[model samples]
Target: MTTPSQDRPTPQDRPTPQDRLTPDELRTLFLFEALSPEQLDWLAERGRVERREAGEVVYREGEPATCFFILLSGALSLNRVLHGDDVEVTRTDQRGVYSGATRAYLGDRVEQLYPHTLRAVSDAEFFVLPADEFAYAVRTWFPMALHLLEGLFFGTRAANAIVNERERLLALASLSAGLTHELNNPAAAALRATAGLRGRVTGMRHKLAMIADGRLDGAGLHRLVALQDDAVQRAATGVSMTAMETADAEDTVSDWLDERGLAGAWDLAPSLVAAGIGVSWLADAARTVGAEHFEAAVRWITYTIDTELMMGEIDDSVERISELVGAARQYSQLDRTPLQIVDVHDLLDATLTMLQARIPDGVRVVREYDRDLPSIPAYGAELNQVWTNLIVNALDAMPDGGTLTLRTWREDDRLMVEIADTGVGIAKDVRPRIFEPFFTTKQVGEGTGLGLDISYRIVVNKHHGDLRVTSRPGDTRFQVCLPIEQTAEATETAESGETTEAGGAAEASEDG
Candidate 1:
């Protein structure tokens, strides 16, 4: 735990603040060397020299950034708070290096909090200017330069947001098309089955009328209705049969029907056999209804069984459609809180569902999720985009079909998700540039080259996490590490940035 500020020594605990630099003394630093004599004088009057002991924080992140500090002597490091732990991002001993309220000139348009913590690695000296004064001097000294800088900063951000949106829409369109294809299969099956079911129901009603036309008494008709119920039950729990076994069963039923002089025996035999009805069941039917009523009773029962079987198919197909629709909603995170504690496995499963049509029959997906891993606070829809990009890249990697594996586990205070592909791996020369913006290996018109770059920003910049890759022929993996707990930096990034959806490159090892 950090000691409260009051418990730490103040400047009074050490030597007094050093005298301000003279104009010539300020010009000795590289940063001020380009300044005019008048500009140097202006800085010398405003900037003060401050000393710090090693291991002391100059300013904590998320504090109201109040000053700008330029190195004079000694070494220092920059650290970002991640999951309550200070993780060092950089260290420098170069004179004139600066830190602190670097973006103060942006004014109230953006929050003025320090983006990272600054710490002295050794007893250090820095020239400090109050943040407001620094902002005034920078704007006054170079108004045009400041305007250009502002344009560049905000322009890049705006461009990224626009492109990120385009990327997301493209992905959504592709997935929606795939979903349409997947939904069509079951929907078509249900449509055809419904029509067939209506016909079977009508045929059963006509057959029933024939059986009860006084040729069979109420008691016999009641017996036939009981037989119909049994047939329907059998159809529900139909037996699985091999080709030869099915052929033999159908032949036996057909022979029995033919021997009784029933027409369409061959056609009727298959449906009866499919419902596990055989010669023994036929004997019982004949005994209950007698010779004259046996044929009509058998036809009605067959139609009843067939109709029940068709309804089962329709039920299964409709249920499948419902499941697909549910998975689509889950994948899109529609109706979900943008930021919430979420199960990683659910996100993975939903991505897989959305990509089901795009995944080739030859490419198999294997999930290796550690269910015990704690849920994490995250932007659900954004993470789904990360999954989509990674999985799509994996599919592209294995054009001829291979295993695509998704694995998740807990590593320290972070959760790690790995997407692996068994395909021609990423080239060694290209690996370093994989996450650079607009760096793609795909041919023109095929990729945007921002998939991994956006993924890196979301995972690293936004989540205060890490993304890493390792590759070899037939074995390539991209691992995304996310903090399981919300850190101060995560909160700051959330407050500062727009949440954007991610997309994948069409080529393997994403160039888009």
Candidate 2:
């Protein structure tokens, strides 16, 4: 084989003009196909073929919609740069053409001005048609003009659809962020309580073992029982008390009880009583068991109560977790089809649960639900997404943590759900675009600015409902209004247990 350098074509070795484009070759381009041979030749003389390397910048947006281009080879990526970042707008392959000539020919106001830039991804070739010639061709050829116009319209629509999708993705990102934050709290609390309960239960088992072993007399047993009682009480107090205070009180009682061996004594109570030690004998034994034993008894009681309280806490935590999971399932409507009859409360509750992970530690969530609310036909998952976005956004505004109040009430024929947050209020200027896609006050990468936009679509476009927001410093509320009835099919499905809508479910509330 010849060496690569020797095999490469020299400048003189390249094809001449006659070889590159024959007279017939000029007529083959789709847009120019209708031109007469003489006209095609005239056009070809003015046309310029340009080559761009990979990663080359071809054009900028808002640069006059001048000469149109037909890509003869390679790929082109299109993007809009906003706020110092490149947001990809679209991408086209080799068969694509970048022509805004229809707008120029029609004399319509250009919707997008450009210094918008285009870059080539690989070595590429394009045919640039002069503005005047292209305009003349478009106006003179009805089919060509119509084709160009249709292409332009389709391109515009595609661009719009891409933009809408981006906005939606951004909103989803924000909602997910908020949801992650919401999940952490109850999860952490439950873990801590579970750990505490394990320790308490261990200690309780040891004390019961000692009592079963007959290691203590009736008096010691009585003192130990009393200590167990006191421990339970103290544990209850711990629930309402500061952690440090609770720990200190617990430690003191535990130490005093240990000194008297009251742990062992209380552990022996049942055996002592079984061995014929009476209550009177045990009371007398308490006097002999000493102040240390009494202290130990008190401590043990406190701890027992603490254990119980912790158990209750764990139970409550589990319930909350269940509620959250249920809410999520309902909100996402994962088990159901895309469109279903949904209970508004289920959607709201799921949204709250999802955002539960995000609410600040100091913030409290309150709910006032309307008992008379009814189910509506909707896309449950999408509607849940709407609620999740709004409520989570509200939680984010309150950095120091305030109250998030949710209310549902019936107005006229509509059912309304309102979510209000006590956070730094929305500014007037930004409020206008809050529901616009990809608009955000959050730091870059921290938010996508799509939450409210998607919410608006879900409520207004999909559900045929109303979504409105009212905000002030320390108070921001979002109101969602939806119809109360579903179509006959929805009702029939619901009756058959094939579908479960969230409407008519009891209003539920959560506090953080």
Candidate 3:
């Protein structure tokens, strides 16, 4: 046995290529303890012992996975590049712990890049075997196990992709139905207001002809046209009033019109009041056209005011339609790139707008956003889905009516978006399993149970973020924390859902 230096080794002291591990030394490692003598001999011949200094990288992630490694001594760390940071997943000094080229058996079927970066936390020694040789040995010696692993691996990939797509479709269908219902109301209102507007215009034209007849002079007509401009301005900037206040104003206008002996005074009072027309304006009309034609002049002014109000209604209806369409586009991210810098508040607002029709009238929605928080790099569309799921869950939690709050803030190197609800919270026993696929408290057919699960994957696996939940009766909050920027390889496995998890040990079984 040779004693290695405690300090970093010099060139003269480094292990030579001729220094190889014998079958007996290879068998000392637990990984090869159960191998037959001939198998150990084969490994002893092909595998080499390599030494690395503290902080030295064995292999960087995304590089060609050329060798399989089994630690023989010293501590090592397994890290994956996530959101522009090297996030350490596992650190251990345990001998026989192996990593790198673990999937070489798949060969050309999959990209054979190192899944993680391995670094020596302390001076380390590893038994290394070329990827091709390791693949051959595994295929020849453990064909059955390898076959089972391949089946499970490929099966999960297919299932996750299909189920993920299905989940999105279900959400899309629901949003589409809700958006259609919301659009129909304003569209119908605009249509009705448009028809009424046409009639009002024709009436105004007939009234104009009567007022302009030999009974009235150009000066009177000019005064009425000038007053029409003021009416339009007042109608455009009309102030909203409580029901009682509005009724009182209408009564006052009605009394003034009745005192003047005008017919349909009650009918015209509301429109006149809404247009800010009062007894003073009516008195002016009486002076300008005299008592006999005063009724015609007042009716003409009423017609003008009514047309302005109708036009205001049509303008509001069109604006409502435009707002709904904009919200739908934001929620769908239909024209935006899949991954981009996104404002969490904008996404929240879009989601709320899309689900507005489904929200109970008794429930109140509140936004507590940190306007100073910067945008984050993410899969915008998938993140929108996450917001939708959390929002839907919050709404469902409060069937009896409560507050749904969306809050955002910056937390250290990450940005957090919190969705909180005042409702019957998740039970202690059920909380742990909420993110498990197909696990749900909702009744059968009411939920797919994949809502939270998919959300977790989107926030965690794709964006390299953290998702947590805290709950108690009347207060349940789901918070998602994401990095502000993404590394070049941040989304390498985003589409595949094959990202690694941070954990304690590598486990005994390779597939585990």
Candidate 4:
């Protein structure tokens, strides 16, 4: 049934109708069949008879609801624009069917805009009544029904607002938890490295004093300095040796130290070997520092290596923390404007990074991104949420670990992002209802089930895009296709930084 409009157009001179139906004629229609003769007379007096030829425009969506229309003859089709195309929603030839000001009893509560375009498929005649008059008639003649309709309308709106906010909070909470887990490891490592570094620097002072004071002549001191520099240089080079190779090198270095009568130096073997050091380098250190000072020199050099490794650890940890912070910022888009041109790849990558902690070791993520895809105008944060939802669902599908693939490409005038997973596919019996709100196969409390529904509203209703999915036993793919160029209305909205709805994910849309 078409919902009616409650428009409040100010009183003004209205054109007189060339034809008007009598109360007896109006009584023939079902909507008037139950009305009293006086009520039918009121409608007949206020309504005009209008006609349209086949294939003529009846009214367009988004136009002001100035009048209420009741079908008298012929047929008309209703359509809504989706994904930049006019999609037929319904067609009717029923005599009592109505459109336009069907919601007139809602008077001024909403913008009195037509929700769908109506076009005559055959010669059509309509009984039209002014929007204000239609609303007056409904409120005056059906006072009880009007109040009930208002209750249903406002109650549903209130429920949707509550659900929308709840969905937003739940998604934010999940992502925040994952982000916190990801940040903690590097932060802890950096703290630990800092503590160890302080003690290493103090110990190095004492070790250097032992070697630097009266233990050696000037030339021998210079030789020890050269060996120290060499050790530091070797430590700067990352050891690219395999596990077996590293073990063999450590054994050889340990034996060489033992053979040289440096029996207590085994503890330094792993660190020196890890620094790309081996027997040849140790032999050079011995000859350079001389036998008298060799042990002290080795000890001091070991301290240098210790401090260097600790500093490297600190640097790595800090860089990791910085990376996570950057990813978090990108994922949230908190520091950036909400609406802007953004690359989908950056959005996808940031989402993956934020959710990295939640991803299982068995589930490997593969990004098959089209770097050539142009950046498009979008609400970056909301789009990130969309990516987050799709990725999380994909991960959950794989309980025992599977591949999660994110692929993006261009198809005609749209850009498509596909999140595919290899897991137990959705059952055909339950797939159709997946996108419905509060519908989930998961146990209660595990899912709010608004994900896909919200996603549909964001992409289709908000962004004028489309989402599709294909599933099988081992592989299921959800594809989100968005217009490469925005519609005029969308562009204006973006330019004005206005927002309507957000991302959601539940099930594949009907476009599939």
Candidate with maximal TM-score: 4
Which digits, one per residue and each the tens of the lDDT, describe model 4 over residues 371-439? 999999887888887888778888889989999999999989999999999999889987877766667
RMSD of each: 7.6, 18.4, 6.7, 5.4
Model 2 residue runs over 4 Å out of place are 1-310, 361-366, 392-405, 420-449, 469-477, 486-512
Error of 4 at 502 (Å): 24
**Candidate 2 local lDDT, residue 491:** 30
For model 2, residues 1-512, the per-residue Cα lDDT tens digits are 11122232233333435324443665655555556665565556555677899988777754776666666678776654432336454566635355433344544433322224567778887766656556555555455645766566556456646765675576556556755555566788889999988886777676665557775678678766654554445444433446575455445444444555665544333222222333444345457556534433433443466577778778877887777667667766889987776777877777766665566679998989886677767788777777777777887898888999889998776778898998999999888778765679999977766567657656654455667788899989899877665434333221010111112211110000
* Best model per lDDT: 1
TM-score of each: 0.84, 0.50, 0.79, 0.86
Candidate 1 on 435-468: residue-level lDDT in tens? 8777799999888988888887777767777788
lDDT of 4: 0.78
Q: What is the lDDT of residue 63 in candidate 1?
A: 92
Q: What is the lDDT, from 0 to 100, of the residue 398 in candidate 3? A: 94
TM-score of 4: 0.86
What's the distance in Å from true for residue 483, model 2?
1.9
Error of 2 at 303 (Å): 7.1
Give me the overall lDDT of model 1: 0.82
Q: Write the per-residue lDDT of candidate 3 for residues 148-189, one digit (tens) a residue.
A: 868776877777678778988999999999999999999999
User: Worst lDDT window (10 residues) for model 2?
Assistant: 503-512
